[model samples]
Target: MQFIDLKAQYERIESEVRARIEAVLQHGQFIMGPEVGELEERLADFVGVRHCVGMSSGTDALLAAMMALEIGRGDEVITTPFTFIATGEMIALLGARPVFVDIDPVTYNMDPAKLEDAITGRARAIMPVSLYGQCADMDAINAVAERHHLPVIEDAAQSFGASYKGRRSCGLSKIGCTSFFPAKPLGAYGDAGACFTDDDALAKALREIRNHGQDRRYHHPRIGLNARLDTMQAAVLLAKLDIFGDEVDARSRLGRRYTELLTARGAGSTELGGDAVLTPFVHPDNVSVFAQYTLQVPDRDSVAEKLSASGVPSAVHYPVPLNDQPVFHVGLPGEETPVGARVAQRVISLPMHPYLTEETQLKVVDAVAAATGLAGS
Candidate 1:
């Protein structure tokens, strides 16, 4: 009944996790430890990238990537407004403007068709989030970026293990960043993140930016932040990486099962009206990690309340579009990006993890059926 069942994952990898951490502890090189480099190499290889720069957190990873790109005041970064605030926050923190673009209703990702219209003279980059563990349409987005001569940054925080058209998430764009927040698909014990790229200069710059701009000991060349990932977290991630491929398969199977079960109960997209539930639509070219297994439900507040009353836990990935948030709000109330604003109000997530049992999953679906007035239909 736990939302993520991290305890179960820990139990499965306890011995390896302990061994890795013990090795780090014995070495006592907490900062810039050997484990960090090992994890980075493994991750880079897994993602099919040339370099992986470990960072303190996903936010810092995004920050460092932007800094490496030289994004700053008066620069405008085009990005979707449907994602986590961190996507926009990083740009704002660097004194850059985050120009909001609406998302596609089906995928809930930035619509590539909208990209051209949003580009302006100051547009410096295009950042697309792989929301809910499925990558955005990278090819189309990259096509647009290429024409505009802009770099594309993939915010792959929820999609670390996902694949798009035979390519991995973090290797799909000019710069890709992912988080190891405890709940993410490939999570660590604590906050951690990494940036991936094939550009040698950008790779070197990212490494330096994460460590006070120091290319070598006490030699600072540019302004930067202390954003290095801790050795302990690197150890945990290394242990998890050993079993991550299997976990990814499990997550995909469970996600499909959830959709099938809901569809059978007359609560699926085919029955999208009244109390029917609208499940996630995965593109044929993409493999999702199902980080949240989210769905769109009408009367979301009441449905959530009923699920809670039935002892079934549910959560919302996001309740408001970024453009509607107080800190980022712009345009009139009705002028907000239409699709994202509407979708945000209806999205809700169920308890999802690789270890989730079918028995437990069935109960969750039954609870949803009851809450949506499709229990016997």
Candidate 2:
């Protein structure tokens, strides 16, 4: 079974995607074409934001947002170490420091209780990643940010369709950035992403930043990068947007099924053995898009090896915490990121997608169970 059934999703929206691409080809305005603005508008409306600035990629979207907020040398951005490197990479790229924080073991997201302690005069923003597919505690994070007068940027790359307290993922912060990586919840044909915000000035700044800091053609207003989203990709996203809601619902149902089936089989006996295995946790106040149906297992390496031997494809969202990564290891003196370290060693992602069939899921579960000697339990 495919880890993420993009093929199935393509089959469902083939005609719409083809037609949208055809229109882009016919128009021949590849750069900053009408489809770009169309997608930006559509995305803005979908995310309940006043503006959406499409960019070259998710990394660029994060960079653009930071640039718009004037995050520069000596500034610090607080975020969890359990997320993708991109979360901290963007801050480091701007010559700013990424203040790594521990995650909440259950949610695998930045722990808000530890947030205030990480902030200092140099803190410019709080970038909380919506890890896996569920959002971090935005209300508490926002409260802390409000007290410190810092902006909050939601890294909603894995959680575009997710909801937190009745608000959409990308609309839950001062600036929300989401990826359109082919593996993301709401993916495009290729590399693409968007930044959302309610503030008009920040929106304008982000637009300029995406286009090499140009207010208009050749009118360089500030240092920026060429981060414009391709018109063709935008067209592709527009087509996918038509059915994204249904896909999200389908994914949620699939997640529920996995939970029910796995729970029924018994967490330890179903797969990876029950010794210290933890199921994915979803908070009652938020809904996950289930970008990855990840779980915690003992001896992750051995479990993955067994799954591989049984022809069941499995992967890890992250094997090492960002704080421990060689590139971004600044070493937070006197701070111990215990939760991030522990989760990094145990988290493993299973095959997850809206189109993943029950039979395929069973095969995967069975393979894991057999490998971990849980088949007879």
Each model's number of backbone clashes?
Answer: 0, 1
CA error at residue 289 for candidate 2, angstroms: 0.4
Q: Top model by TM-score, which number?
A: 1
Residue 68 alpha-carbon offset, candidate 2, angstroms: 0.4
Q: What is the lDDT for 63 in model 1?
A: 94
lDDT of 1 by residue, 1-377 (tens): 79899999999999999999999999999998999999999999999999999999999999999999999999999999998999999999999999998888888999999889999999999999999999999999999999999999999999999999999999999999999999999999999999999999999999999999999999999988999999999999999999999999999999999999988887565333344579888899999999989999999999999999988889998898888888999987527588888788899999999999999999999998889877452
**Residue pairs in candidate 1 whose N, alpha carbon or C atoms collide under 3 angstroms:** none
Measured with C-alpha atoms, the lDDT of residue 292 in candidate 2 is 92
Q: Give every collision pair in model 2.
A: 268-274
113: Cα error in model 1, Å: 0.9
- Candidate 2 residue lDDT tens string, 1-377: 68888889999999999999999899899999999999999999988999999999999999999999999999999998888889999999999999988888788889999999999999999999999999999999999999999999999999999999988999999999999999999898789999999999999999999888999989998988999999999999989999999989988888888877666656632232337556788889998999999988888899999888877888998987888888976566213687777777788899999888889888887776676555343
